[model samples]
Every structure is written in structure tokens, then in C-alpha cells.
Target: MFASEVLRSVDNMASKRSNTFKVLLASLAVAALGYVLRSPSLYLRRETKSSLGYPKDSLLNFTELTAEYGYLSEEHKVLTDDGYILTMFRIVKARNCHRAKRSPPVLLMHGLLQSSDSWIDSGPDAGLAYLISDACYDLWLGNVRGNYYSRGHVRLDPDKDPAYWKFYIEEIGIYDVPAMIDYVLNYTGFQKLNYIGFSQGTGTFLVMCSEKPGYCDKVKLVISLAPASRQMHTQSKIFRTVTQTFYRMEGLLSMTGLQEVFSKGGFSQEFVAFFCQLSGVTERLCEKVIDAFDHVDSTHLGSITNQTTRVLFGHFPAGTSVHNMARYGQSMNSGRFEKFDYGREQNLVLYGSEEPPQYNLSATTVPVMCIYGKNDGLVDTRDVEWLMAQLPNVLEMVKVEDPQWNHMDVTYSQYTGDTIFPKINEYLLKYTSA
Candidate 1:
């Protein structure tokens, strides 16, 4: 009886051990499944326009709209230099609108990680481009290389090749901006043109003057909104830290072929959706964080919608090349627009060691009127003041009184007309001939 009892007890213990193993395996499987679902692959599948927590269509109608499609047309064409085919859009406000016979035409440039579509926020009204065009100004929107619009015509494919993806604001300043400006001036039969840039758009302008000084003469006037000259003293600790971290990681990723992985649309869109979900939790939290990074006043948080928040966070910044991020880091650290240090500071050659040269502000003889917001985070008021002090001839410097106007508010905020457009119109009209 004792022997039988012993055998039965051993079997029971074995059974318990087996059950425990099964339970642990099942728990691990569940945890892994949850993780995979949240991974980029699964996230991409569910994170579409609908999944990003955009407002109901009916609700969006209530918001102030920018411009309609009627005012814009798209074309795929090659730029004069380097034969780089770029996506271009032309905006004509009036059929025969002519400024003073000598007044330069205006070319509008969008910032990094954004497309021309950014200028037009598709709801009820027109975007900045339409507003300027409607005010009787000939507006031409220029898309930088690698955004959804201007990705074209090179030996490198934005999708398949690392070379195509290898650029930052410096490249935009050196190649893309100059190419577009040349094309626009030549296409319009104008000798000099007015230039307006926002955020990275302004950074590229600085780059242009630094790398290609002759191009500055082609520009008659410049209007820089939220200009970023030296980013060493940026307001956002998070941006500073994150960008710095990414800058250091560029080498490892480049060697491993993971740099190009981010360029994939599937991965990008999924990442965007995941962030959008977080933004939806309480639009205020998201806006506050954005405000913190951008240096905007948090009180104006109500101005941004969940959709806009998602779009800006998810799609706008997108995947930047590690090399590009490193350059920004070097610029941030040095407080100068130097070429990205690829390991050697012009001494050691890893990739391209030539530090991007600093822009000569003295050469920017164009009549410039800078507009900045006190609450802007990306371009601090101090930087704007510093930039103004550097410029040889500044037509005017206007700081908006509204605490709500953020860096992006210049283009995307509803209060643009009340706080910004009126002032811009006042300046433009001063130059306009009756």
C-alpha cells in the first residue's frame, strides 16, 4: 500500500509541474502577441486617417478652413540645374496683377519634414499660400527634395537607396533651394525675386548664402517666419536631448543598413498613427508637450485640433536620416551652420567631413521683414532678435502680441489673419503700387 501511495504522489507532482509549464508558456505567448500587435507592422495596418483619431468629418467642417483646390495646380518637372525633377505648384492671385515694375516676385518655401500640402490644411478655408495669392501677390510654393512632393529624378531612389535619403537642411539650402529659386526666376522672367521661408525653410536660406553667396543677389526681399539661425539655445529640452541622441546613433545605423528602413512608408505611417492615438487621449496633454518643445504658450492649447496635432507629430517630422540629424546636432552644439561632421572635422574622412559653412548674414542685402512670436519654441524671440541684429538691412521686426501664436501658428493657426496676416498685408501693401 505504501509503495502504491508513493508512486501516485510522484505522478501527481509531475502533473503539477507540467501544468505550471503550460501556464507559463501561454502567458508568454499572450505577452508576445500584445507586443507584436503594438509593433510597427500591426500599428501601420490600423493607423490610417480614421485610426489616427481624426475628428468626425462633420465636426471638422466647423473649423476655419484654409484654401480650396481651385486655387492650386500641380506639375512634375525638372529644375534647371542638375536636372533634378521636382514637384512644383504655381499660385496666381490675379490674372494681370503687377507690382511696381521692379518689385520682385515672391517664392514661398515650406520647412523640413513638410510638403506643400502643409500650406493648405484642407477644411473650410485656404492656407498661407492662398491667403498671400488672394492678397494680390504672385505666390510660388517650393517643395524641398525628399518630401512626398519633391522626391524625384536622381540616380538614388528615396525608397531603395541610402544616397537619396542622405541629406538634411544643409543639402536643401545648398542644392534644392537654389535650384528652385533659379527655376522660378527663370520661369517667371524675373531678375530678382522675394523669398519667404519658415522654420527649416529659413535655415536653408542661411545655408544658401553660406554655400552659394551669388544666389543672394537674385533675391530682392526676404521674409523669414520663426527663423532658425543658431539652435544651440533652443527651448525644448526634449528636442535637444532626442536629436542629440539620434545624432550619436547615426554611425551604427548607417553601417547596419537600418538607416533606410525608416524611409519606408509602411513603417513611417504606422509610427505616425501610434503617436496620434496618444495625442487623442487628451488633446491638451499633446498640445502642452508640443508647446513645450516648440516654446509656445500653453494657454492657446485650445486652438489646435486633435487632427492637426496628429498630423504634425506623426507625418510632418517623419523619418530624418541619421546623418542629417547629426549635422543638426553639430550645428546645435557649435551654434554655427557647419557641414555635418561625419567623424572627422575636415581632418578625418568618414563620409563628408566638410563642415557646412556659416551663412554670411552681411551678404543678405535683401529687404527683410522678420515676424516672430514671443511664445514660439522652435525659434526663440532672442534668436530672432539676434538675427535682426546681424542683418545689414532689416525692413521691420514685428512680434505678435498674442501669447497663443506658436511657431506653426504663423501658417496653421486660425488667428493668422487677426495676428499675422494683417501685419504682413500692411508690409506687402507698402511695397505694392496702386
Candidate 2:
């Protein structure tokens, strides 16, 4: 009898080891395929570079690019309570425009795996940051903790410290957003500041209000462009697949200490940037690659110009922790906008319950204007309706008038000046005394 019990235990252990090995192998293949996709050099011909002109903007950082466009730019650093050192950018006004009247401060936060660059990447005419500044609003851009611009900590090394990469959207809401809010208001001496968040940026602001209810009093209004929280009905199968791959491999990744993904200045990101520098056919193909990730149809590609596409690759796929990706996966699967789930055992310890807590959307009392694309691949209208129903104060819900507008179009679309910015400006004017 004792021998039989020992044999059963041995078999269980062997089965567990075999399962772990299989999971690791499959996860590695998925990771390698992603890297290969970004590595355009492996598949493309050398002649493609013949006519390609290198984008000078690729080499320019946020402040440099702003200055190049004749905008007065300033950089400010804010240290989070938990030791993250984030860099925030400000466009005080156009260098050429001299308005004696002081503009009210309005903070613009970028989405996941993006930095301050997204707002200005499309140049002065269409870029949200430039337009807001041109309108005499004090424009401030906020970068989350782990992206390209804000990769610093008081003690831990990003490259060496696995602990440094352990944060997700929850931490951004509870720590990063509040820190930026306090800094911008303190420096500008404003009682409140307007906020504009794109994609995950919207999620972070919602999380902030949900987690720290008092912070809602500090915002005059929130302009949510392509707002996303739960992606349960997202149309982008590719994005869902990638998120699931990371979610399933979390245990193995935690064990191996592999935490960050698509880091800025990494080989994959740089190669994608180089490939995008090639003009004509190659650039068009690169746009298709972006389209697939965005889950937009081919017809939707008309909204973004070739130059905008090239400039976009220069700084995008910025970087985020693996845990952050997994958090999205959790929401996608469970169809709930909630805190990070740490498995049944760890969740009990951290949350005092087997299930993670759902964000209290009712606590978000700030007047919000939600602008979403009908064809957005990452956020479905159903989810947006669900979110609206939960919120106590939704000032407006404006779907992009353009039928082809998708997730990327919210920031990079050439038609935003005609399609969306007017409404944004109108909403801001209503809330501002200036």
C-alpha cells in the first residue's frame, strides 16, 4: 500500500513537470514570433532601403521634437510616492504665439506602451498636444512609470530589478496619475486642471477616481479618447491572442524573472523603426502590420497618412511590464473591470477574497466626455455602454463621426481636426472660465 501511494505521488510530480515544460516551450514560441514580426530585417530585401529617407524625428526626444516645431516646451520631473521618477512634458504655448493671457493647465496622458511622443508624433496641424497649445490652453503630457520617458526609480534598476517591473494599470491610477496631478496643479497654481486621456490613459484616470475618490475633485473635466477598461468584446483577435499568451505564461515568466516587453531602444523596437523609415511599398506594408494589431479593416487605413505611419513607428511599442498585459487578459477573459488577480491562493492574501475587487465606477464623480470610435478594435461600444451605465456622471458620449475611425485613429488620424477635435474644444470651453 505504501509503495502504491509513493508511485502515485511520483506520477503526479512527473506530470506537473511535463505540463510546465510544455507551457514554457509554447510561450517561448509565441514570444519569438512576436520578436520576429518586429524584426523586419529578417524577411525584407536590402533594396527596400534604397529610396527610404530616414525620419529625423526618430532620433529626437519629446522636448527636441516640440522645439523643432516652434513650440515652447518644458520638462518637469515628478517622483511618485512609491519611488517612480516620471518625466512630464509641457507645451506652454507656441513659440511664435505671444498671448499675454495665462492659459489654464490641461494634462494629456498617453496610452499603454506609449510615451509623451504620441500626442506630437503627427506634427503640429493634427497632433492633439499642438492643437491644444495653439488654442491657448497650457498643455501638459504625462508619461506612465514604465514607458520610454519615465523609466527611473529612486533605488531599483529597471534592467536588473524584477521588482521594478511588477506594476500594472492599478498602480498607475493609484500612484502615477495622482502624482502628476499634484505636481501640475502645484506648479501652475491652479485649483483644477482638465485631463485628456487616450485608450489606457482613460483607464488609469478612471482607476484613480475609483481607488482614490477624493482625487476626482481636482479635475474640471475628463476627455476620454478611445476609452478602454474591460475588453471583453474586443474585435482584435491578434491582441487578444497576445494578451492570453502572456497571461497563461505568467507563472513561468515570474519564475524566470522575465518581466518587461518591447522595451524602448531594444533591438525589436529599433528594427521596426528602421524598417518603417523605408518609403513607398515597405512603409505601406508596415502600415498593414499596424492595422492587424489595431484590428481595423483595410478600408480604415485611409485615415492615417504614410508620413504619420512612419513617424508613429519612431517611438511606439514603447514598453510595458508583462504583468500589465496579463491584467488586460484577465479583464478580457472574466469580462470584469477589476483589480489584478493573483490566483486563488495569493489573491486571498492580497485582496482578502478569492476574487479581485471590481473598480467602483460610481466613485468617479468627475464630469467625463467619452469619445470612442464605432470601429475601435480594442474597445467595443457594448463595453463603453456598460461603463457609461456604471458611471455616476457622464457629461457626454460622442462616437467619432467618421465610420472608419479605429483605435489608432484617435491619435494618428489625419481627419481628427475635422472629425473629433472640434467637439473636444467645445467641451473644454464649456468647463473653463478662460
Candidate 3:
């Protein structure tokens, strides 16, 4: 009888241990969920006020001025092929003035992670938008889908939906640029418009020509600044690795509806702050990364503005998706503009069930002028030379002699008005009455 009682006690002990294990696991799960929920808020609070790069007020000022330059008196909107409503801001150089009839309109496309605000920063000086406007050329700035402005769609919400994020630079070329071109031409009542693109802005134009052949006909002239068509020479090892990893996980994340997790303001803003603190040492590291990623000379780290650096990290670097970065890595690895590999060389089946198309420069019949800084770390001079050779309708290829002018100098450098703007103005004036 005593032995029987001992066996019952043993069974009772086993049952209690099992219940305790279950409770521990449940508590762990709840803790993990709480961490996930609070992480974004913590990151946002830390990054929003961090002064690792430039002051927030200065960046905000720049954003405001850029918006002012693009504001149109009339309500301007366009619909993307995917049924997304894109908001466009316009500024007419001439109102009730005869000069508007003669001068061709210039459409300025900002690079990745940049909005229309990137074009202007309020100081004693003027931005490219104002300079072109002052030169009596009608300047219109464009904002891409993911930036601060132009975030809207019929079936997607960038803030709450993963479908909105299911795109990269390729989509911009295939849908965004073409739609903007069509809208601009239709609204202006012009047969063709002048095109100017910086960095990824120029890359998308190449994509448009590759994916859709008829697009170049709508453009009368094209000017590319720090243009990046091939990334084989790019130097950022971290960027390449991250992109490769992101591509591998894209499918899993999309399935889990966690694709929009990065879009959360808390997460994104915190990332910005973290990088800003790293900017002190990492800025130099960033220059090297950009140089290596673009196959430029890493030895030459030129002067970059604190504001420009902040914009790069807070606004540009973290803003792009892993899918986009993977495509860039593929482009760099192949030295060609092509679709991203979805693993096992299955891009053909995954991205459209066909081999990604190559950008065809011969189809771009527009008058194009390629401009580059001699010391640019992103778009190497050799790549630009090769790209120029591919184009059939080149108007002029101008290389700036300034050795200090790096990739961002075209937009942010103090000497832009004194050195670069004059050259651009001279070119536009040839086709404009002013």
C-alpha cells in the first residue's frame, strides 16, 4: 500500500512539471510579441531627435522649399498603369508670357529616396529648380512612389499593405516614369518634353527604354547626372550582402504580411537615427561603400555637406527595399541592367516567365547629354563612356573638370550655381528663348 501511494505521488509530480513547462513557453511568446510591438516606437523616439549627422530643422527647411518649387496653381494628378493616383506638383515659369510658347518644358526626376524637396534648400542660395526657373525654363519636379510625396494608389496602401511595397526600380521604369511622361506631355500639350534624371532617376529611363521601346519618342532631350546604368564597379560589400539576403527572404516576408513592417515610422525613423550616430566614422565608410558598389576610386573621398549626408542615411539608404537592392546586386554582378534573380536563376519564371530585357540605347531617339563629375564615386567615368558609346543620338557629353565634385555634388555642393548650373543653363538656353 505504501509503494502504491509513492507511485501516485510520482505521477502527480510529473503532471505539475508538464504544466509548468507550458506556462513558461506561453510567457516567452507573450514577451516576444511585446518586444516586436514596442521596438518600432523605441526606435522612432531615439532616431527622431538624434543629431548624428545634420540638424533636423535644416533638413525640414530643405524639404519645404522643394515642395514650394513644385506647387502648381491648378490641381495636378495622374494615374499609374496599376491604377495608382500619383500627385504631381507643377511650376510654370511664364504666366501670360510669350516665352512659355517657345521654350521646351524641363522635367526633373529625383534619384531614389529623394522627393521633390531634394531640389531645394532655403538659404541665401537657390536650388536647381529655382535656377532653371529663373533661367526662364519651365521646371517641373517629380516624386517617386515611396518618397515623402506621391504615396497613393487605388488598391494599395504604402503604410498598411504589402502589395504597395511589391516593387523596385524596375517598376519605376516600367510604370512610374512612363506615366509621368504621358501626363506631362498631355498636360503641356507638347509632342515631347525635356528629361533630366539624377542617379537612379536616370537608371529608370534606361529601364523604360528596355522594357517599353516607344517611351523614348516622347522625350525631346535627356540629361543624366551621376547616372548609374551598370553597377558592376560598385563597392559596398555590406549593401551587396544585405540585398542578397533580403531577396532570399522576400517571399517568406510577403506571405507573413510582415513586408510592411519596415515601412512603419517607428522602425524607419529609428534606423535613421542609428545611422546618424554612425555617420561620424561611417560617412567615410559610406563613401567607400558607394565607390566600391559603383566601381569608382575609393581613394578620393570628397567634401560632402552634413545635410547631404543626413539625407543619404535618413532619407535614401534605408528607404529602398531588399528586393531593389538584390536587383542592383544582380545588375552589378552581370554588368547589365536586368531583372533580379529570385533564386535558382528562376527570375524568368518569377518576374514574368521570360528573361529580363536589356536596356536598348538605340531606341532612345531623344537628344541626350550625359554629364558626370570626373571624380564621381557612384557612376564611374569608364561606365559613362561605355554608356555614351551605346547611345545613337548623343547631343553632348560634358565632363566637369572639378576633381572635388563627387556624386552628390551635382545637387548639394555650394559651387553648383557657380560651376554646374551655368553649363546646364547654357544647354537649355539653346532651345529656349530666354
Candidate 4:
């Protein structure tokens, strides 16, 4: 009997060994496949896009998405002084409102991994783009250099050129934002336009104002939503992990020839985009994934339906330089809002200092209003307080009234029109002629 029991235990041990071996072999096979393919994609195997590396309609832009919703979106290509060609979307007419003959031009800039698509993702009534248009403001959405919408350049190909990816937030401040501002001002024939920036948008604007004090005169007022300047006090682990290990991990990623991080071609991106498109169990999983960083509020789920969520993820994790993420990481470690750190020797050569210089908030002369969320994990209240203390012309500051409001909710909440937009439009009206 004892011999039989020992034999049974040995059989169970063999079964466990076999399962472990199978898992190891499967993992190796996947790694090999990913390496051979030069990329891993769930659907795309062949290269379809000819002008650039990606396929057309492979991802939709703000112009395309907004037009589908019965809005007239004009696609404008603006050339940056640094040679990048950026696509900026303008929503001059919407079904909800007649074309504004004399309304002010409002430039709404998105955050990290976000583009103009984010503004329209929440549907017409609640989406910021539609709401702004409904409010009779001529809405313009700005896309930064490296995002999916604005990936073109006169000389540098984002998929091939390593030098194109060398810029961080400093460049976005000095180049991208200024370029967009000039383009909008020139296009609309306006002396100054209203600026609304979220996260990195706010960061870039802050940097732009600091570097070129005269640019502040070009903006009537600044509406900063979830303003991400000093991320030192961020609560999200994902934000912490990326910003902290960025120096080493970014180098490894760049060495792998990955200029665009988690770009549209990857299996991981497709998988997440597809799975989040599903309802029931899949959507719940997506909620958990987004909530891990932004914090959870079930009421805010309507802004991110399956269809809209797919568009958001597909266009997003969009693509940016490894350096931009690294810049945010640098901000997480540093005390003051400053330029990118090039360590010691490079810092002296670049900024004539051993350390990166702080952005002069005193020069951000535009009347500013900051709207922060209580439950936001990425941008904390402490960080917002620090930012407020430094800036000279803070017009007003308010927390999202909802106790459960998180970072994502500031954009994704279906109730934002009811709760947030009234306040935003109030401040924007102060500068507008109407």
C-alpha cells in the first residue's frame, strides 16, 4: 500500500513538471516569433503604409473622428521651425451649433499618449470638443510632434530617424507649442487665442512661457486641467515606474530600434485595444487597467464606451520619443520645474550650469486657472499646490467637486458638462469678446 502511495505522488510530480516545461517552451516560441517578425502584431503582418511606416486609416485622427460625428473638421498641416510637420485639427462647425462667425478660437492641447481624438471620444454633448463648439467657441485641437496625428517631418522619419526622438518636454515647450500658437494665430487672424492644456500640454505651455516670455502675450488666458508640472508627488505606480527606470529602460528600448513606444503596430497595443472594445468581462478588465493609474469611479464609465474606448487606445499609447517620457521621469525626481538634465558636463554645455535651470513661472504672465481632481493619482494636490505657489498670475483654482473624480474623469467623465464645463466656459468668457 505504501509503495502504491509513493508511486501516485511521483505521477503527480511528473504532471507538474510537464506543465512547467510546456509553459517555458511556449514563452520561448513567442519571444522567437516576436524577434523574427521585427514586431509583434495580432492582425497586421504586411506593411501597408507606403508614404511612411504605418497604414492609412490604420488609425483615425481628430479630423476623421470628428467628421464622422457630423462636425466639419479642417485638417491643417503646420511646419515647425525644427522641421517637423504636425497635423492640427480645427472644428469650426458642429451639428449642435451654427458656424461661429465671431467666436474666439480655443486651442485645446492633450496630455501624454493623447491627441485630438481624446477631446471627441466622449460623444458630442459631453466631449470637450463638441461642448466647446456648442458653447459657440471656435475649437482647435493641437497635436504635438511625436503623437500619431503629427508624426510627419520634412527630413526626419520618426520610424527610422533616431535623432528625431532626442527631444523631451523642453523641445515641446520651445518648439511644438510655439509653432502651434503661431499657426493658429496666423490662420484665424487673431492677435491672441484662448489656451486649454491638459497634463503635458500645461507643462509645455509653462515651459514655453518660461523660455520665451513674449509668447504669453499671445495667449489671452490659460486653462490648465490636471496640470502635470511637478510629478514628484504622483501616486500611480505606473507613472512612478516609467519615470524612475526611464534612463536605463529607455536606452534598452532605443537600442532595440523602437523609436515610437508601444506604437500601433505592436501585438500588445492591438490586444489591449481589441480587448477593451469588448463588453462584460473584457471591459471590466479595461476599467481596472485605466483605474490603476487614474483611480476608479463607476459613474464616469459612460465617457469611455466600447467604440470610443477602442478609438482612444488605438490612436493612443500613440507614440512619443523615449526622451519625453524620460523628461517626465526627471521631473518626478527633481524639486523645481526645470529643463532636462544632461547630467554634469552636458548640462554646463547646454544651459551653462551644472544642473538644469528652473522654468521661470513669473514669466507665465497669462491669467491662469487650474482644475485638479481629488482622486487623481498621477497629479496630486501637493504637486498642484507647489505649482500654484510658483506661478505669478493664478486667476483661480478649483478642485473637481466630485469626491470620486480621478485624473481620467477630468476628460472622460460623462458628467463633465454638468460639473466642469460650466466653470471652464465661465473663465473663458472673461477673455472672449462675446
Candidate 5:
């Protein structure tokens, strides 16, 4: 063949290759832009909203409700060793009831994405803060780091710094729990405080006991309500989807400044509140949406006043680390309660192991009473039993008698005060002088 003919053929092939490379680059650019545009927080705004049925006597925040209820409440700013500034609230006593100044202190820690408001959103009639105060226990509510109330940090601003988002349940268990516990014990002048935790609250406490067993000595009797660990058997498909699919987007989302999950005043929460209050068809479906994730006890649903549901959800899923959600997902996949997975190579560097270390449940030596519902989907019965077996000193396991008593109902249900609190009160009474 002629040299020119051969050169011409080579040039044509080079031209074709150039065009293909250009197309590939353009496609990648479009895909990156698409991911940026699809911000996770805004994904839920694709709906027409009418009303939220916001309470006529809506309370603004935990402190606001404390004043409205005439309860004595104080807010404390605790600085974690890891540079997170967490907010914790305390209810000294019930204003309506006369209690001795020396009332025993009880610290109630809320679950994942929840804040101090969880204790009071049910109103004075049934709220745990009020009932505890009325029961003569100096009640305190703790907001874990990354929630709405505890979003501040000593060195990092959550809104502006990506580094601020570099934590999960492990950091919370190790840093936030111990800091808050020490703060509460110091402030209350108590040798040890009675402790109660719900969901992630229970998980963090258990983590604290394992990572820092000394804290367990400061807790008199730990009550775990709907304890969340090893979510292997979680019934909520959405929860599992989030732990799996949605969590996979965290790196991309955070790169676009969407690190905070379920951001307040964001589209997702607004859409939920608005859609949940529609008159007939949508309303029932919305209620079922909640029931599907938690249990659907009609009696409890009936007791959940419009104001309660409206106010409670407004503060919930408040915010947390993307890593936190991802870790929970890993737990579901691995069927073991363990530390966050930072890939295999990174895990070796960070943890000196190929896989993340399982939380040392055996190190949790506190006298623990686990209260779980048969219908609780988040913490399956089998998972709770596994948690019980792992704990070194689980005193008892109380299964909620009401077959339909799902997770949230343990705190927000209509009969929570009657059915659950009595048992809790009895336990507290038994250990009151301890």
C-alpha cells in the first residue's frame, strides 16, 4: 500500500477516537451537573402543598413549651472533646406539683434525628418531661450532636464546613454521650443519675458503656425504650432503602453541601407536614405512611392529636451525619452492631482492621432494662433479643403488652402515660434510693 494511503487511514481513526472522547467527557459533565441539581433535601418538594394543620397554640421550641407549660427548664451547652457543641435541656421540677428540692434527677436521651422536644411535644398531659417532673424526678432531656438543637461545633460550623459532617453514631457514642453525662452529673450534684434512652439514644448509651465503661458507673438504672441496634430485620422498606440506596448518595450530596439530613425549614420536612394534613384520602395514606414505619395502633393514632403529630414531626429527623445513617445501614447489611465502615483499605488505616470493629456490647455493664414492642419495626423482636443476649448485665426485658405498640408510640401514643409510664415509674421507684 502507498505511504500516503496508510497515513490517511491512521488520521481517520485518530479523528474518530477524538470525537468519541469528546462525547464521553460531555456525558460525564452532564451526569455530575445532574447529581448537583438533585440535592437530597429538595427531592421531596415535588408536590402541591395546601396546609399543615399547624397547631393554633403552636409552641416554637423546647424552651418555649417549657414556659407555656409553666415548667422550669434550663438549656446547657456542652462542648464535646471532639469539638462539637451539643445542646442539652433540663426540667428541674413540675411547676404545678410541689417536689422536694432534692428530687432525684433522671436524664432522658432522644433517638436518631430527634431532639429534646420529643419529651414535651405530646403536651403536659402525657409528655415524659411533665410526667417525670410530676412524678418528682428532676427531668432532663438530651439532644445528641447533629440534631437541630445540637448543631453547633467549637471549631466547625455545620453549614459551611464539610469537616463538621465527618462523624456518625460512633463519635456520638464516644464523645457526645460522655460529655453530656458528665455535665448532667456535675450540674445535678448526683453520684449517678437514672437514665432512659430511645432508639439511637439506647445505641449511643450502649456504645458509651463499651467504649468508655466508666460512664456506666454513673448511670443508676438504664432504661432502653425501643432499643435500636443491628437493624438487620428492620421492617420499614424506606428505612432499609435509606440505609442502602439513599446513603450511597452521601458523598455526592455532601460535595454539593447537602450533608445535613432532613434539614429544618427545608423542602422535605415542609412537604411532609403539608401532605400529612390533607382532608381525606391523602390524610389516611399519610397516617399509614407513619404506621408502616412504626406500628399502627389505631388507639395510639387516635390519641395522637393533630397538634402532637404536627409539632413532633416538625422537629424530628431533625438532622444527623450522613455517615451516621450509612453506619446504621451497614449494621443492617452485616447483621452486627459495629463502627462505621470507611472502605476496606481505609478501615485498616482508621481501625487497624479490615472490617469495622463491632461495638463491645459485652462492655456495657449497667443494669439495663430493655422495653421493646412486639410490633416495633425499627428494632425487631429478634434484634432486641440479640441485644439482650449481648449485654453483660441486662436486668430485664419488658415487652409492651399492647401487641400494636410500635416504636414512637412508646413516647407519643395516647396510652403511653397509662400503659408504659406506670411500669417505668415502678422501676424507677424500686431504684429511687439506689
Candidate 6:
């Protein structure tokens, strides 16, 4: 009787082991099938780099890419007041410039999760940095702290110290922007520089202008592209869902010590590059996914061809802290452009109230030109109008004539040359002294 009972027990254990092995095998089979389906060569005809007309090399950094296109480039390091160090890039010579004298300095700031490379990623023809340089402006591209290019601090290490990644957009507005502005002004000997900001770039600029209105005098004109403020009316379903998820998972992320997302040399960017480059089908699918977040359709991805999109993936989502994403989530939840919400208890300690304080947009006295697209998925037109109402000095508000133009279109689309850069040039030319 004892031997029979022991045999039964042994059979049960073997049965459980076999079931687990089958499940593991099934998972591997599914993953392999998916990879095969997404394979570039087996699924679609692959296009060579020469056919695409972009550079043959993959993942070239900013200065190398600029030099590859026959443009002279220089790099600068900016030390912020708060111990963070940032890398700034400049197009020292414009290919098409024939003017004897250099125009006043123009500084271009990038949006969230991006580096200064965004300005030149689309190449000389459509890139605003190249265009501004060709237009005879001393163009300077500034990278915010915590991105791929500017991930340095005086004391804390980003990889080891939790305190190193504690900053949000407000810190950027108050410290990063001002430091870069001062560095550019002193370097160029220009009293003021024309500013062009896209998405989060626009938000940080507003924060800088509002918090330190004196800096307003240091900016001759602000060309805000897709001003990303008051995002209560955001249209992207994917964006809404993601922000909500991030908001809910903030505590979990903090507990797990996962402070950064899409960071340089991180898994997020590597996965993106691998998944997007799998095949033409996957590339289109990738575009569709971006469209889901930006509410952009296939029609709007005009100049962002497959090759260009792949190259962009190599540089994009450079990096940002989870804290910054959570702040955006907080704004989405409250539907107000306010300071970081530290919950009721912590908010009381930091802000002297249960609720976080709102940025005083009324204090922004800079000459501003607000540019937005009608179909932008992330930033609703109503929010832009609401922002315009709050600001004290709005010079002009120009809506892009293209009906299908979306958020990323402002920076990456070929249509920007005809649809936006002309107006940007007019404003910069009007405000600057040759």
C-alpha cells in the first residue's frame, strides 16, 4: 500500500513538470513565428540606403551627420546653476550663406524625449537648423539636461543616484533654459536671441518667461511650435491611455527604482530600433503606432519616409526621467498647467497648499508667435487658444494651412518648408538686426 501511494505522488509531480515544459515551448514557438512574420528580407523587398538617399551609415551622432552633409559644426558644454551639464551644438557655417555679416543669434530648443539632433535629423533641406543657418543666422541648438547628449551632473551619477533623475520640466524651465540662454548670449555677444521651441520646448520656454520675466528681454522673438500646454483636450487615445497608465504606475516605478524611460543605451530604444527596422510592414506599423499616440494619419507622414523614420528611431526618444512623464500625467489628470503634484500631504509642505500652484502665464511678457496644427493629436487647438488668452503679449497666432498637419509635422515634415519655415523666417528676420 505504501509503495503504490509513493508511485502516485511521483506521477503527479512529473505531470506538473511536463505541463510547464509544454507552456515554455509554446511561448518560444509563438515568439519565433512573430519574428519570422516581421522579418525584413522574407516579408518585403528591402531598400538600400543609397536608394533612400540618406547617409549609408546608421546611428551617426549630431556633429558627424552635420559634417557628412558638408556643414561645419561645433560643440559646446553648458554648466547649469544646479550642477547639471548640457551639451549644445552649433552650425558654425551654413552651406548656402552668402552674406558678409552674421545675423543675430537664433537658438532652437527641442521637445521632450529629444536631443539637439532633432534640429538636423531631417538633413539640410528640411531641417530648421540648416535653414536658419542658410538664412544667415548664427544658429545654436541647445539640449536639455538628462537627454542622450546632456546626461551629466557635477556630483550625482545618473546610473547610481536616485536623486540625479528627480527633475521635471519646471527644473528645466527655471535652470536649464536660462543657463543655455546665458551661455549662447555671452558666446555670441548678442543681447538677445530668437527662440524656436517645439512641444515641451514651448512649455519650458513659457515657464522660463513666466518665472523669470526678466529673461523676456533676452529673447527677441519666441516662435512656439505646437505649444504643449493645458493639454486637457488632448485628442490622442493612445496618449491618454499611456499617461493614465504612467500615472497609476508611478508609485510602482518609484518602488522598483526605474526612474528613466527610453534612455540612451537602454532597452526601450534598442527595442524600438529593432522592431521598427524589422520590415517595411513593421515600419508602417510603427508609423501607425506613432499615429495612435500623436493622432496622425498616414497622409501626414509625407516627408518622413521609411528610411527617414528608421534613422529617426536611431536618435529619437533619447531619454527622460519617469518623474517628467508622471508630471505630464498629473497635468492630464488635473486638466491644468500647474506645478508637480506631490499629493495633498507633500503638496502642503512644498507649495504651502494642498494643491500645486499654477504657472502664471499672465506673467509671460515676451513677444510670442504661437504656431500650431489643426490636426495635432497631443495638443488640442482649444488648449492653445486658452494659452493665448492667458499670455500678456502674443504677437501673432498662425495656424498651419495644411488640414492634415499633425504635431510631429512641425519638425519632421517636408511641408514645414512651405507651410511653416517661411513664416518662421519672416518673424526671425523681422526681429533680428543684420
Best by lDDT: 2
Position 33, candidate 2: lDDT = 51
Give the whole-model CA lDDT for all candidates, comma-separated. 0.60, 0.78, 0.60, 0.73, 0.72, 0.75
Candidate 5 lDDT over residue span 1-434, tens digit each? 11222222223333345654344334323322332221344433222221234553233678778778788778889999988888988776577667474345788988887778878888888887788778777777888877778888877888778788788877888999889888988887888888899999999888888898688888888988989888888875556765665457767767676666655555556555554453443344444445644642333344456557766755665777777877777778777888877789999999999998988888888788888888776778889998899888888889988787788776677677886798788888877862
RMSD of each: 12.5, 9.9, 13.6, 8.6, 12.9, 10.8
What does the lDDT come to for candidate 6? Answer: 0.75
TM-score of each: 0.76, 0.88, 0.74, 0.85, 0.84, 0.86
Q: Any residue pairs clashing in model 3, and if so which?
A: 233-294, 233-295, 234-292, 234-293, 234-294, 234-295, 235-292, 235-293, 235-294, 236-293
**Which tens-of-lDDT digit does each residue in 286-398 have in candidate 2?**
66556655744545546788888888887887888989988887788877889998889998999999999999888889899999887887888888888888888899999
**Candidate 4 residue spans exceeding 4 A from truth:** 1-60, 296-307
Q: Give the Cα-based TM-score of candidate 1 against the true structure.
A: 0.76
How would you encode candidate 1's per-residue C-alpha lDDT over 1-434 as one tens digit per residue? 22222223223333345654344334323332232111243333322545545433311211122213344344535462544567767654332334433245677887645666566552224256656766667667777766555667556665567776677776777788888888777887878777888878887887788678798888877888888777776665545654675577667767766443233244434443344454333343345445545554434454555555654444444234556655665656875545565544653454343554456777676678888888776677877888788888898998888766777776667556567777676766665544
Candidate 6 lDDT over residue span 49-87, tens digit each = 335433342367888888888888899999998999999
Local lDDT at 311 for model 4: 49
Question: For residues 1-434, could you state the per-residue lDDT of candidate 4 as single tens digits?
Answer: 22222223223333445654344334323432332122556674434222323323235566766777788889889998899989888887877876454446889999887778778767776788888887788888898988767888899877678888888888888999999999999988999999999988999999999897699999999999989897888876656665565654666777777655545556656655544544454444445456554653323433455445544665656667777877777788877888888789999999899998988988998999999887787888889989988889998998988777777766666778987898899998898876
Which scores greater on lDDT, model 1 or model 5?
5
Which digits, one per residue and each the tens of the lDDT, describe model 3 over residues 162-193? 66767788898889899988988887788777
Model 5 regions more than 4 Å off: 1-53, 57-59, 101-103, 278-283, 296-303
How far residue 296's Cα lies from its native spot in candidate 3, in Å, is 4.9
Error of 6 at 86 (Å): 0.3
Pairwise lDDT winner, candidates 2 and 4: 2
Deviation (Å) of 144 in candidate 2: 0.4
Which whole-number lDDT from 0 to 100 does residue 26 have in model 5?
A: 42
TM-score top scorer = 2
